[model samples]
Each structure stands twice: as C-alpha cells, then as structure tokens.
Target: MNAKNSIAELARWIDALPNTRRLAGHELHNYRKQFVDGWRIDLNLAENVSINLLITAQFPFVSPKIALIDRTKFLSWPHVEKDGCLCVFPPNTNVDPYRPVEVAKSLVAETEALLQCLLDGNLDDDFNREFDSYWLLSSDDLRHQFFSILPDGCDSQKVAVWSSSKFRIIGADEKSVLCWLKNRLQKDYDRTDTGFLVKLSKPLSPEEYPDCTEALLALISEDAPNFLESISDHIAKSFQPLTIILAISATNGTNYGVVELCRLLRANEKVSKCGRSNRVSVNGFRDGKAPLSVQLSQQTKYTKVVRSPLERADAEWALGGRGHDPRFAVLQKQRVAIVGLGSFGSFLTDNLIQAGLGQVAMFDGDLMRWENTGRHLLGGDTVGQNKTDALKRRFETNYPTIVSCESNPVDWQQRIETAESLDGFDLVISTTGSWKAECMLNDLHECSGKRTPIVYAWLEPFAAAGHAVAIMERSGCLQCGFTGAGQFSRRVFDWPAAPTTMVSQAGCGNEFQPYGITDSLHSIAMAVDLSVECLLGQLTASTHRVWINKDRKIDPIQRGWSVAWQTVPNFDTREEVVSEFPWSARPDCQRCS
Candidate 1:
C-alpha cells in the first residue's frame, strides 16, 4: 500500500480509541517535526497522564514513537526517558508494512500497560532490573569516557584506576589495569590510583542517587562507615581524578554505575625560592590549616561527582555471557594443548579461543608462508613468523580475555615427547594430519595413565570429508582406528586407487591439498565441538564424528562411495551433514587386545 493509505489507516485506529483525538497545527509540530500525523491520548485517571503518539513519515515500515507529554512527575519512573518518550517497545522492533493499524493498536496497548504498571507501583522494582538504562541516561559519553576490567561480583573492595586527561580505566588490581593498557594502547603505565568499589544491598531509587562527592559519602556512611573513611583517606592521597564503581546486587543481576570525582588539589608539590633551595609545601592548604584529611572531608560536598559509563570488558562479558553464563565459566577454567597449527589446527584453535578457553599451549614448528594465508587464522602480516608465535600474538591481542597463551615453536615430536609435559592440561589435541605424530601423542596419553583425553582431527583431500576421533581411557587407543600406515580402517570417500590429488608448487618439497577456507569450517567445528565436550566432561565414551560434503561432484579420479557412506540415510541426496559413531575397538585390532 502507498504512504497515503498507511497514514489514513493509523488515523482511523487512533479515532476509534477512547479518550483520544488528533493532535493538529503547531501542537503536533511542537512534539514531532517530521510526523505525518499524531494523536494525544489523555488517560483520564487520578495521576492525569497524557501521551502523544506521533506517526512518522516512515509509518507502516517504522512503528510510531510514543511520548508521555505531561510526565514531569514521572521522570524517575522506570523506562521513562528524560525527553518524556516511553519505551513501550525495545529498539529495533519490526513493523508490518501491510498492517499499520495493528501496529499502532499494539503500541497503544503497550503504552496503556506501562502507565498501569507505573500507577500500581509494579515498576518500582524495575529500577533495579533496568538500572543501567537509567544510569546511562544521565551520562555524558563524550566527557565521562571510561572502561572497566573489574570482575563482576558482590564484594566491596579497593579497586585500581588508571586515569589520563582523555579517559579512565578501572580494574580489580594494578596488574590487570596495566595488562589491559598494554593490550589496548600497546604501552604500559607505572602508576595507578586507589579506587573504591562498593556493593549495595539493593539498587538505589532515583531519589537516593547522589549528585556529589559528599552525598556519595553520606550514602555510603549509612552502612559502611569504615569504607567511607577509607575512601576519604584515598582521596587525600590521590593527585588525579578518582573513580568509584557502584555495583548493586539486584534481583535480576549485578547492575553497575560509575561516579568520577575531579581532583581537588595535589597533596604535595615542591616550590622554588627566589635564589635558594626548593621547599615542599602541601598544595591548596595553609601552613597551619586544618589537617589535609579533615579539610578534604569538608571539601567533598562542593566537588561534583558525575556519573560515567563503565562498560564491563572482563573475560566473562567479552565471551558474550556478561558474567553469568556457566558454560563460559567452565570453559574459562580449561587448559587445552593444541599439537599443530596447520590449516585445520589453526581454524580449530581460533574456534576454541573464541569459545573462551582459559589457557592454551600451542606447539607448531612451521612458519607461515604466503600460501597458508588463505586458510590460516594468522594473516599475511605474519607470513614469515612461526605459526605458533604469530597465532599467540593474534589471539592475545584480539582476545585479551584468554588468561594465558604459551607458544612452543619447536616440533611437536621434540616438545611433547613425554606425557609429563602434558600433566596440567585438561585435553590434548593433535591436528597434525601426521599419523606418526598422532601415534606418539596417543602413546604419551596412554603412558600418562589416560589422565588427559586426546582428540585427533583430519580433513580428506578436496575437503570432501573430515573426521574427529576422541581417545579416552574407557575407549580404544588411536591405533585402533588405523590398521597400518596413515590409512584409516574405515573411509567415507574412496579414490580410484591411482595417483592422488596432491599438487606440487615451485619446489619438490612444496605439495599442498587444494581446498578453500570456507570449505574447512565444518571440519574445524567438528574438532572444536568434540574438544569442548571433553573439556566440559560431557562425553562419556570415545566418540567419532564425521562431516561429509555430499554435494561435491565425484571427479573422474574419485570412486563413487564406500560402505561407510551408506550408513548415513539418504547420503547420496543430502547436501551436507554430520554423523556420529562410537569409537569402539575392532575385535581384530592388536592395540585393543
């Protein structure tokens, strides 16, 4: 329908509503400049509420914006913006172009429901649930720039703040602050200020929120007089701006608010005499003035504390859990050892790092060549660097949430020769595609008394199929899967028993399997998923997972299919799929016997 019909339909719906009329002339213009039409809803109730529904020029495609026109007394209410706009729907609510009338009707219903909740005192508790929204509403993003690396918790303690003229960063300790600065700014600072962090028993209502340093102290003094005294002492010593992060243990979750107070004066500074030695004097104080601490206590009332936005940049929040996700909490404790950094291993390590693994030990001997850039996680910038070192820099710089990443640029055979080296690891993964290396890792794992599970992953040529086999104590060893040599006992895609599809580049040693980056994602996913399961203690027995790209056309050099392919139902027709099987020992396998 055209814009004309859409506006007319909205008008009809507003006309049908009770106690409503079209807002016209300068009245509508005063509220919204670009609206095609608007309506005023006078909610004839005790509190005398009035709402304005402005239908914008992009109606039908965009929902109408609702404003509470006469809401001066309701500014403190939850979801009520400073501009009197009611957040009836969250941002990015989609509108049906063909059904403009229903859209307006639903918004009207939402606005009514919100007003009812406000009158019933039902939204009073929402102050805690939506505290960040209201707190941020009062913030000036340009002036109050800050980032927080502080771990979210309900404990009140002394935190550290790194402040400069441009911005500030608050963290749990000096080390974390310095580490974050190194990761963000590529530089280190030697100084940090002591900051106060207090956990409130309950979130403050708008009325209880303090606007200045003295009020903040008064608010704290009620329950934590000793903490307030400590904060006063910190202020006396600080020569720069101070930060105090307020955390409320709300019913829903921990809500945060930041208050930054400008420095009143430097505690001590040296003054040069006309022609004599320098003399140190306490700045902003008379020689016989009241003690600096006592004066500071009195000066705080005039010092304004502006509310700043403190974003959580810690690992849990960066991992997308916002600190409450158990899966990430568990993953953050796991230490994984990746034995290779080839194409498959590179992508698998990237996935596991993104999944929030706490620490990783990487072993790869090869340097990244230009040929590996297309599929490797490390880009061309690190072409000459060792894959392990390059990947360590890449992941640590990009994902600072990872606790530690150890890169051993030696051959896996030399680095992990014994099981003792893998003692502290939760899981050991070998994606080397070298059966010899995998055999050694398997033997080492068995020698370690099967304390750490091992997972071996590899991709078939042309990326037509991939496999991830998990080896644990209860299941057969890695040798059980392979009969002899590098060949698996069972194969999904078979070849015509001629020359394989390996291609040679300029040199005799340069041979590579042809595959694109996108084609390897599924295979990477299979290995990372199995590794996560083992880390999370979700897997009970050894598991074998395979992904087949059945859509790939069978080339002339390729045989049709093997018996393993027949196991998947409709294998010939399905485009792409994954299947799982138990990695049980074959009765004739000598390793199991």
Candidate 2:
C-alpha cells in the first residue's frame, strides 16, 4: 500500500470507532510521522476506561499495538500482558497489504471483546488458570531471590536455613555466586544444623517503601501512605517474623511467590549481620508502641529481600535442560565405560554425555592423528597427543556434567586384564572397531556371569550400514553373530565377495574406509539409542539392531546386496529407522553355544 493510502484508510477507521479519535501530530516510537498512526479510545460506561492504539504504517497489513492507559489496575494473564497490551490476534496471522480493511475490523472486534472481558469479571478466571504464566510474565518485580530446598511441611520460624526458605528460584547457583559464601555457622546459629548460604542483592531501599517496619509491608504493589498499617496492627497477633518471600523469574520477566518474615524486634537485641563474615550486626528497634519520636527518629528501613524464583531444576531438570526426554533421568546414576576414543567412539560418547551419562571412563591406547581429525571430536591441533588425554581436556571443558571422565591411554585389554575391573560400571560401550577387542570384551562379559552389560557399536564400510549389539546375560554374545573368518566370514551385513573391503593407505599397516564423520554420526546415533535404553532398564532382552542407509552413495558400487541385508525386512527407508534383529544364535558359535 502507498504511504498516502495507508494513512487515509486508518483515518477513516479511527473516525468510525465509538468514542475514539486520531492522535494527530505524534512520534511513532521515535520514527518519523508516516511510520505510525495513533488513535485514542475512550469507552462510555459506568466507569470510563481508555486505551491507546499505535497502528504501524503496515496497518491493515500488520496488527496494531494496543495497550491500556492504567495497566496495574488490571490482572495479568495469557491474553493480557503485564504491560496491559491485549494479545488480540492469534499468532502468525496473514495480512494482505492490499487490504487494511479486514485487519482494522478484526482489531476493533478484539478491542471490544477485551473491554467486555475487563467489564464482566472474566479476566479473573483467566488469570487464575494461567497463574504461573502470568506470574512469570509479570514485571512488577525484578530483584534476585535466594532459594532453600527443603522437605515439605517444614516450619518457617524454625530457621531451617540451609533447607527451606519457602521460596522458588527458577535458577539455583551458589549463594556466593554474586558474593561470598556467608559463615552461617557462627555462634548466632547451631552448628549441628545444615544450611545453605544466600547472598542478598543489596537490601530493598526506602525510596519506594518509606518507613517500612515489618517485612509484610513489602507486599504493597503500589505507593500509599502508611501501607504497613495493617501489618503493624496485626503485629501483636504474630509470634515470629512474618516471612515474606518474593520470587522473580528470568522467564517472562515476572516476579512470583510472596513470603513475609516479621518479628517484634527486641530492644537492644542486635541480630547478627546478614553479611559475609557475620561480623557486623543489625540493631533491632521497630516497635509500634514506641514513641512516634522513637519510630521517626530511627533510620527508615525496608526489607531488601527480593525473592528470586526457580523452576525446580534438579538432576531430572538438568537432563531435560537441552530438550532431552526426562526419562533420561534414569541414567543419572549409571556409570559407563567407552572402550575407544576414535571418531565413532567420541561422537557416540558425546551423545551419551548429553543424554545424562553421569560418569564415564574413556579408554583409548592410540594418539590423535591429523588424518583422524575429519571424524574425531578432538581437533587436528590435538594431533600427536594421547587420544584419551585429548578427550579428557575436551570433555572437562565442554561437558562438565559428565561427573567423572577418567581417560587411560592404555589399551582396553590391559585395563580389563589388570587389577581395575569392569565390576563397578553399569554399561560398557565398545566402539574400538576391532573385532579382536570386541570379541575379548564379549568373552569377558559372558565369562563373568554377565555381571555387566556391554554394547558393541560399529559401522560398515562405505557407511552403508551400522550395527549395535547388546551382549548381556539374557542375549546372544558377540561370537554368536559370526561364523567363518577372513573374506569367507558369514556375519551381519557382510561385504560382497569381491574387491577386498579394506584399502591400503600408502603404508604398511594403515587401511581405512572412505566414509566421513557425517556418515559415522548415523552409526553413533544408533549406538547411543540402544545404550540409553539399556541404561534406562528398558532393554531387557539381548537384541541386535541394524541400520541400512539405502541412500548412502558408495564408491565402486557392488553388484548386489549381501544375503544378510535382505534378511532384515521391517523398516522405513524414508525415516531411516533401524531394522531390529532379535538374537539369532549361530549354530556353530563359540560363545553362547
């Protein structure tokens, strides 16, 4: 729409509204005049209410911004923001620039419905229904809060300090974060009692709350003469400091939770300073019965307690912090061992760490090399360094929640053979890509009464397929999936009997598949999925899963798919779901025979 036509149409709509007028000659949020067209809305009712509309130059194309003149007088809710702007239009409304007529009409109807809601007492119900949302979105409070987690039904006056403060904080850091941890163990409190130290944000000042005596006086949302009169009147009726806790959440910038701590300060009773060393003290003298000369003469005090709200983020909360399933919480206590530090192992390990693998023991005997950088999590700069050492530095700096990531540059066979055993681990992941190593680990697991579960994750040549086999007490062992040896080996996803699957790299001992990290990540994904299920106690049976990439572009393409590939039937090629193969015991298998 042209600038001239936009203004003329808006002017026409403004003139047609009931008790409304165009706000001529105004600034549009600091933009030039043509940027916005303002309008004033005055409703004729038993009690008159007014609204301000600031329609953009894109009006009839974009919805106009509407706000109430006095916002605090109304309740906060989903549709009505704390700033009193009404959310009239559902999100993502399509606006045709050619037609401001339709948008103007819809906005008018929304404004009428909003005013009616304000008049009919329907907002009260909406406010209650979305109380938490409104509370989080409310901006009346912004002071940081201190949180104390406690058992339910704890006493307030009891000063269960470290445990419960009757306040919720959306984020919990050490009380010493913004400051130092206070010495709450001084003679002022019992040492036997456990407590958490909370740092105050600089006490609430008397600028907004003048001459405030009791903590309960902080409840007044607006300024008033003697707002603490009710708190003072009820002072004689209480035995403890009326604890009032106000919580401010960083979410929608709202403050919620009100707890008051009020007490009759004893004369000459100096409470220990709520400061760091407990060295200084606050003098107590807020008695209403005291002479007006005494009360007025004293330094006007305001409770500096601004309640910071928390979203109840615990270990389970940490698991879902990155949009992960909360069910991953089941792995919080499980310890895992990743038997390799190469690309497939490291990539798979990262997935496990993010999935709440609380502690991990990384085992790798090789040194990170430049060639491995294309697929390894540790970069090329880490070349020549022990793979395990590189992984330690990477994880400690990047994935701290992985509690314990002890890396040993020593071989897995040595570790399993030495005094330190796998008895302490919940699950062992073998991505060493060595058939000999996988066989040894499988034998150890099957020999030791299957005391611990070990998952073997490996990828096929050309990244065409990957397999994760769970070798446990109830399932088939690794040797059960293979029979024959060398080029004649009949296994899951065998290569076609043609040009050797291995390629020599210009060296005596180096041979590798021409696959990229992106290809390996698919294999890593399959490994972690099964590992998570096993850790969460969901995988009760021994299972073999195969993932075939029908779209994988392999060089030197073979004539036909292997017999093993055609055996697996049920899967979605579009979604790339894995083909599940339940334990099929090899007739001539060495283990689990």
lDDT of 2: 0.57
Q: lDDT tens digits, residues 4-66, model 2? A: 687688778778878887666643443322446677877544577787777765565677777
lDDT value, residue 461 of candidate 1: 61
Measured by lDDT, the strongest candidate is 1
lDDT of 2 at 360: 84
Question: What value does the lDDT take at residue 241 in candidate 2?
Answer: 35
Q: Tell me each candidate's RMSD, in Å, in order.
A: 4.5, 9.1
Model 2 residue 242 CA deviation in Å: 17
Per-residue error (Å), model 2, residue 382: 4.8
